[model samples]
Target: MSWRFVSLPPQDGYHMVTSFVSVADYVSRGGRNTLLVFSVKEPFVNVGVHQEVWLEVDLDYTSKAGIPVVRRDLGGGTVVITRGEHDYFVVVNQDEAPSDPKALYAKYLSPVVEVLRDYGLNAQLKDQDIVVNGKKISGNGAMTHGKAVVLAGNILMKLDVDLMSKCIRVPTEKFRDKMAKDMSEWLTSLERELGYVPPREELDKKLKASFERNLGIKFEDSSLTSEEIEEWERLAREKMEEEWIYYKDRRHPELRTERCVKISSSVAICHVDYKARKLLRITAKFLGGKLAEVSISGDFFVMSPKGFIELLEERLTNLSPEDIPKEIDRVFEEKKPTIFGFTADDLKKAFLEIVNKPEVREVI
Candidate 1:
């Protein structure tokens, strides 16, 4: 059946979040139909559901700048969304969507890649992020809500690097400066790449056309049903509270000690940082050309028991550098562990980088 579609009118950040959630519920209840929603809300700082706003965002700056901080139901690092950027949300029945999150991302987000390519950008999905010239151009995440799959992300018309950097509550000014510089280089936008923001109206037309052709589904204009409106109100009241935004993430704290140390030629310790739908930080030590010990820690959501992650790490220890990926793949396949917004491959690549370190550095 054709999916119902809605382009939500621009509203405050809280309304936008609830509207998307409300629409996703349409599929959760045996509706059997999907929903494609496009929304752009007022400028706000949004943090992952698990993240503490005070830890990652500068509350003072956000308050003074009139940018409200919100906690999204999805899991990911903090992000800034402004008025003009495009935010796409796809709500599909789990039975109709790919069972695997990785495949689900590639399937639904392919049209987005097509749109970017049509504009002459070399876009591809790499490490789950949409990248061009090895820099990220779009960010995405996927999660299951009841019987529905919710995929959400943004297409950058332009990015405010200074504001993005200043809004984050990093440890020091030096770190903030570095964060701003890195964002400017590693993150990009359509305006930066094409020299001007494309007409959003035309872009919306292209998106609808591309999705129809790629997903083999028609989109008919639709309105929010009375039931969804009620759900939206309830969710807004529950999800938009200050306590939710400031809730502490129980994941491992930032490693304060040295993360890298060189033991000798071909034997060293290294740390690798990776991101997909969630942050992944890994610490690995190599000895005798094999993994001696490794630890995986981050704010990523793990549905397994508390010790499951440790067991996965233990299963990988002492494996050859080349064999780590295969083992990680096997564990994920057999356990069917759920880490929201990430795949086994995303975790493997992070571990491999440390094992494949090309240069030795002093303790960090």
Candidate 2:
């Protein structure tokens, strides 16, 4: 059956989120499956439904800047969203959607990757986020909305590096600065890739076209049903309550550390910092039993090509346990990057020095 297509009118922070959740509920109650797309009318701090806003958001900064902190019905890290991001949601009957989160992301987001690649960017589905040239272009998450399942994601059009970093609570200003730099390197947008933001009207047309081609489903033009609207209105008010924003993300004070900690029960996030003549900060994510994302940032100087560190970081990924040293050697030999205060061997040691445990407990 063709999906009921609703292009939500871009509005303030709350309704932008409630629209999809309401649609998902409608689907749960035997309404038609939906493909929904919309953007926010203003920038807002979007907290995951499960996140503790106190830990995830800089509430003071947000209040000062007039950016509303919105809690969405999804699972992901906190992010700052502006109209520059285009959001897409697949709201369907639970019976029709994949039960596994990975399956859900792969099925819906892979097609968006194709759409991105068509615009001359080398895009791929790497785990949950979509990336282009090792930089993430999208954030995605899925959750059951009542009896229906809704998979949601955003096409990051232009990331506000400074604001994004500032809005998140970090251990220190240094961490926030590192975060801004890391985001500038690792996260990307259509504006950065294409040299100009594409027209929204054109983007809107192409977005649906890709879904039709990729999923083999027609989208009937539609609007929110009266029932969905009422639900949206109710949710819009409820989500604004303080209780909803900080629903369930409090940890023990002892559990709080300067370094990264747990995202959920299963995931452990670790940030390794080692100080020598020069500082090195490593943000690592592993996939397929290999290094997936390795962002090395600090006051280190490299004398190869202009993009030597970026090249090194890229090559360091997807390496096996033993291949790391070999990979480091290959990069040093091939690129011949000279450091003012560090040697290639030092670089290799620094990487190995921190990654010496089963759980990534500490770094020297």
lDDT (0 to 1) per candidate: 0.74, 0.73
TM-score against native, each model: 0.73, 0.69
The alpha-carbon deviation from the true structure for residue 39 of candidate 1, after best TM-score superposition, in angstroms, is: 3.9
Please write out the lDDT profile of model 1 over residues 191-294, one tens digit for every residue. 88999998767777788888899998898877778998899888888767766665443232332223566768766777766776667767677777777776
lDDT of 2 by residue, 1-364 (tens): 6888788778788887788789988888888889888888888988765345666688888999999999876545678888788888888888876765557778888778888988999999976689999999997766666778777788988778988898998878999999999989999999999998887777778878888888888889999989889989999999888767754433212233335644443334455666655555555654444665566554443422445666777898777546777888898888775443356677677667546644443221
Range of the 10 consecutive residues with the lowest summed lDDT in candidate 1: 249-258
Question: After superposition on all CA atoms, how large is the RMSD of candidate 2?
Answer: 13.7
Residue pairs with clashing backbones, model 2: none
Off by over 4 Å in 2: 249-364
Candidate 2 global CA lDDT score: 0.73
Candidate 2 worst ten-residue window by lDDT: 249-258
